[model samples]
Target: MFNRLRCGSGLIQETVPRFGFGPGQENLFVHKFTFSTSKRLDRDKSLIYNSQNKPLPRLDPSVVGTGNRKRAQPVIQPSEKFNYSVRKALELIYYEEESRIPTLFPAGLKLSRYLKSRTLPLEIDLVSRAVLYNTRQSKLEKIHLQRWAPVDFDKNCAFSYLVARTPAEYAVLVTIFREISRLEPNFKPRTLFDHGSGLCTGYWAANTVFGKLTEMFCVDPSTDMNDLATNIIQQGVQNVPLPKGINFRLKAPKTISLKYDLCLSAYTLMEVKGSLERLDIVHSLWERLEEGGCMVLVEQGTNAGFQIISEARDFLLRLCEADERDGIVDNEKKGEVLAPCPHNHPCPRYHHDTVPCNFSVKYSLFDIPYFSTEDVHNDLFSYIVIKKGRREGFRFPRLVEEPLKTKNNFYCRLCTGSGMLQEVMCNKKHKDLFHLSKFLHWGDEMPVHLEYTDGKEKPRPVIDRSERSMSSGEHFRDSKKEKDFKEEKDSKEEKDSKEEKDSKEEKDSIVKNGI
Candidate 1:
């Protein structure tokens, strides 16, 4: 005995007892049901069986997706920050004078050329060997000893730097600080230590990223530079008071009484006369960093700049290891690399590749006199962030290059946690991973797990340059293939023209014959 229940455009056949039953008696016996639909249901509709004919829960529209797959989200890249302080400083100093505007262009060019040609001072021991080898003379020349001259940051030089370099420096610092903020949302620094703080760019950038700070200690050796920075802080026009808890000094304090939550050294190490002095400065900065604080170091994107950053990274790591071994520092408080690297092992790029690992940020150019030819420019920089704590357990692979999106798959060159550079591919077959790959950018961490074997790492495969171009969504053809294509196209055009001419001639003949 069966009963037919009417549903929307469907029939449900249910098994029940032959006798009429009351509401409570319906559940006394076991019942079986089969449902059939005359037409297909819409995607938004769902059919559910209910013996009591009660109302059902509504579905959430937001959770619905195409084929139930997760939707792809947009990737967040480094953003440009409008430097109001720099703009105000420039306007107050130059006063929009037409005469002063034209002079800025030449000064900027001269400053750019000088900074690019600058190099570290040569060692005294190397000076003697080089003189003997080059001049073939027994005695070293005094000229060789006097070759290295330190840069003098006079008023003119300071003005030139503020015009040519401040915007780029601010942009780089902002990018680094934003990265730290994004990765560690709870990081709020109470005090900042800006080493070699030229024009106090670090303070401005930090303020932009982390709001107000309790104290900022800035140290620089140039009195003119310090004065310029102070003037900029005061905005020159209205004699605005300096920000609270901000201090400037011509040299660092001798005692280590104060520890800061954030320490920054940007484009400063390269100015040191020797490597030993740079190391000493790095160690001192590390000492001043409070426990669990972060230390940031940034340099130019050149190979020399990369070398400087790497040296600092290695020296700090070695120092931490030595301290732990000597029972001076606990394992829990050891310093670790925080960004642009996924592992504490030696950098693969430093040991294996000739090219340096660097990233670029596009920043808006200041509206200075004669300097606004391009509205935006790219600032290439190398930076390393070190935090004083044990390394986190979960680490992600960093994309070393811009991801390539082909028609079939996405390719990414990654620096894995295993200390190897690998090229990985993601396709539609990998549902979630493919969706995630679409949002990846260079210098971003990939949220995927990788397994490693216990043996030696494998070598990277040698890929042809042409193939790489094609993989990057570029259509490239060999010379022979291009020549053949051209020939075929020409022949087809010739044949079509000849046939048109023949048809016209035949029609003319027919008209002449009067057929």
Candidate 2:
């Protein structure tokens, strides 16, 4: 069915990661590979394999060799022209049952045959053309799709070519934007610079929410993707219900000298030329922002600040340990013990688990528009706003007591204890979990209390008990229950402490006695 391009595929099947070079560029190619699970073969099934070695059924001519019976090629290249063979292939797949379509190659051949006379070297070119057309026609429906805007949607094209490729980045961008919007309304930015704008998703997002004349600049190193992105943006601008005023420029970062009000880098920093080189690039881009300008960065967000590190770890754990390369494993004697990826894929000799991680570390080091002025160690994807210079005094926004019931449980972020909460309680009871300033100082409303840590000389004042609001409760029964709970917790702590102390003493005695 996928052979026909008439079969409709869901986001799960359609969203494979495809890679390509620029148009008209030599070595330009796109690869589509799908990965799915298969049930174990029933070796005991007597009919499945004859002990005497019976030959399998002959290949169906309609399925395999019929494509050789090519009709007359149209004058125009099927891929070059907007209509004709590509459309036919698309209709074929879009109309078929999801289960009937077996592989993308069949659908690819149908269009490739129509365009084979065009002399294009790669079959992927036709596929790319076909999928690009599909994306333009398909509307993203999920909130993550809407939020990530152009980038996630753009990567959705990759779905046809890649395995385990799911672009959920849009949700992150939208969450940050929505939070910032709700936090500071008057701080609407007028100009934005996206450092590594793969497919210009941020531009679409900005256009979707702000709708003002926000000058947008998209930068990327890949010439072909940049071209595709440029086309996508143009297409979006021409058709998308955009706000009345908006200007867009797709150019290299080095060329753009105009200072912007905001800058964003989504999944681009990790793919930069090098580490120090990427740092320089970020600095150069940062300089092109006016005072009070902010920068937003998004990436894979891993432990080591480099992309290769995370990729290596993921490969070792996922592919090496599993000993399964899907279908892309290289079987010929290449001196390597195991095929790195699935059988015939075009990635390096490794299993790719994620985009790189450079966007996380270096971006956090620099000062941007406004947020924290201290050293930041972000674990997962982080939201940062760096301001240029000191401005007028400002009042902090009131902390919203976020209700646990309202938050999505899909994502849970991590950080070392030194960074923030050690084991942050994101449970429904802790609604205001992220409001850092709430527990800062003891005040009139809060009671002064003393708490002690082990190996300390004296007890420390963790909280002032007198300032606690529940201290003045009029109901004796409720107050008694509260006091009893506290006492029970204290008793448990004492018992644990005694056990620890006794264990330590016993160890010391044993050592002294030379056990």
Candidate 3:
């Protein structure tokens, strides 16, 4: 969604310059542009028109999509702390090495001699061919879907997951490794906790740029990803010496108390949905890091984070537009007021301040070269690095168990013990009735409502709940009681019926012989 504000006749455009390219270079004039809340740019004021010295009609930024379109504006800014750290590191490398060199990692098990025998061409060819035959879009494609090859147990394809890895992903990982290596030269990261380490492409990137870290903790819940990571680490990897005493823990929860030297999380946090859980994850990472440890986060700028900020802004703008057009305030409009400062320290945006989540998200990015000579651009991904602050001093305001109740949000008529109506019914009475029927739509399945002790009805017995796992003792007791009850009832009924039948037969025989 895009927010279009009505400016007087013309719109304001912000132009940002590209760095590290010569004027003659086609990539030199990379445009870092973003759409304004106002109208289209003044045709006369825009740089392209000025450079060409030609009169052009007014154009809206919305019309420009790709190639010949204006670029997105930079939303993030690099702070002094971040800028200084990057600059000092670059200076140190220049003074010490006299040239930029990629950082090396600990040798686990060197398979270079074996890797040379297998060229990159061979690996890529195999990956492409296999993917062609196994892709979801291909009608003829068929997947064996076997973790282990049937023909040979020992022979495994390390490139299985890499076959599906995307180009954007590859680019992001490479960029991260390059930047981290530039920052810390001798920082041979011993413990790598790769959260959501999808496929082995990340491991491949790590191996290529940083060599073999002492022990790579490839953390991912996907069985396919885990298999691929294991295969890549154990198979014919070049120059990466597998650590003899290294530990590999997969799928299960990690209980090791050891802190990581460098933690790399790419495309991890964007998947976090719940606000509370997201904050917890960040805090957990902070706690896991050793003092002065480095954490590098790379996400799809196009898909996540501030990328969604645009959508949120557009939503608010539309809400306002609807209200103005209708001349009546919609219920939603009341909550659409923007915070005074979107990026305030301990920001109120997304309720970060009150939540246990803590991170100084700095907005910054570099101008990357596009394939065309005329176009230089910013890749949406921004790199964020935070050094763990003093643990004792880093106390956030105590997390309120629940958000403060206010009058404006307090009167939620729909949820006020009323089932989508004007009348208030005991929610407890309705809850059980609702649970008994499968006809009601509750998302993809019937809604399960447990009896609430204080709800409109008395709490149900503990055993009535379906979720309670029956213990062995309870199971035996239940079966024994049921069997005994059945046996006693059957015996009593059988005895009474038999006695009545005997008396009737005796009376019938005497009557027949009376004649």
Q: Best by TM-score, which number?
A: 1
RMSD of each: 26.7, 26.2, 31.1
Per-residue lDDT over 1-515 for candidate 3, one digit per residue giving the tens place of the 0 to 100 score: 01123389874333222122222432223222332211112211111201111111121223222322122222232223322332343343223321311111011012211211221111234446766564464333222211111111111221221221223354556555654564445455656666667654455566557776666566655564554344434442335655463444544254547677656666555455433444455545545666556555555433124332333333434544566578764443222211111111222212211111111212222121111223322233434444432111111111111111222221011111111111111222343322222121110111122122333454334353256657669989998999999999999999999999999999999999996
lDDT of 1 by residue, 50-135 (tens): 12222111212332234422233222222233344445666777465324646765686587655544444665676656655655
Ranking by lDDT: 1, 3, 2
In model 1, the runs with Cα more than 4 Å from the true position are: 1-83, 91-99, 117-120, 134-149, 237-241, 367-374, 391-393, 452-515
Native-referenced Cα lDDT, model 3: 0.37
Each model's backbone clash number: 0, 51, 11
How much lDDT does each candidate structure score? 0.70, 0.35, 0.37
Highest lDDT scorer: 1
By TM-score, how accurate is candidate 3? 0.32
Show where candidate 3 strays beyond 4 Å: 1-161, 164-167, 236-256, 307-380, 389-515
Better of 1 and 2 by lDDT: 1
Sorting all predicted structures by TM-score, with the top scorer first, yields: 1, 2, 3
Q: Comparing candidate 1 with candidate 3, which one achieves the higher lDDT? A: 1
Instruction: Give the RMSD in angstroms, all C-alphas superposed, for model 3.
Output: 31.1
lDDT of 1: 0.70
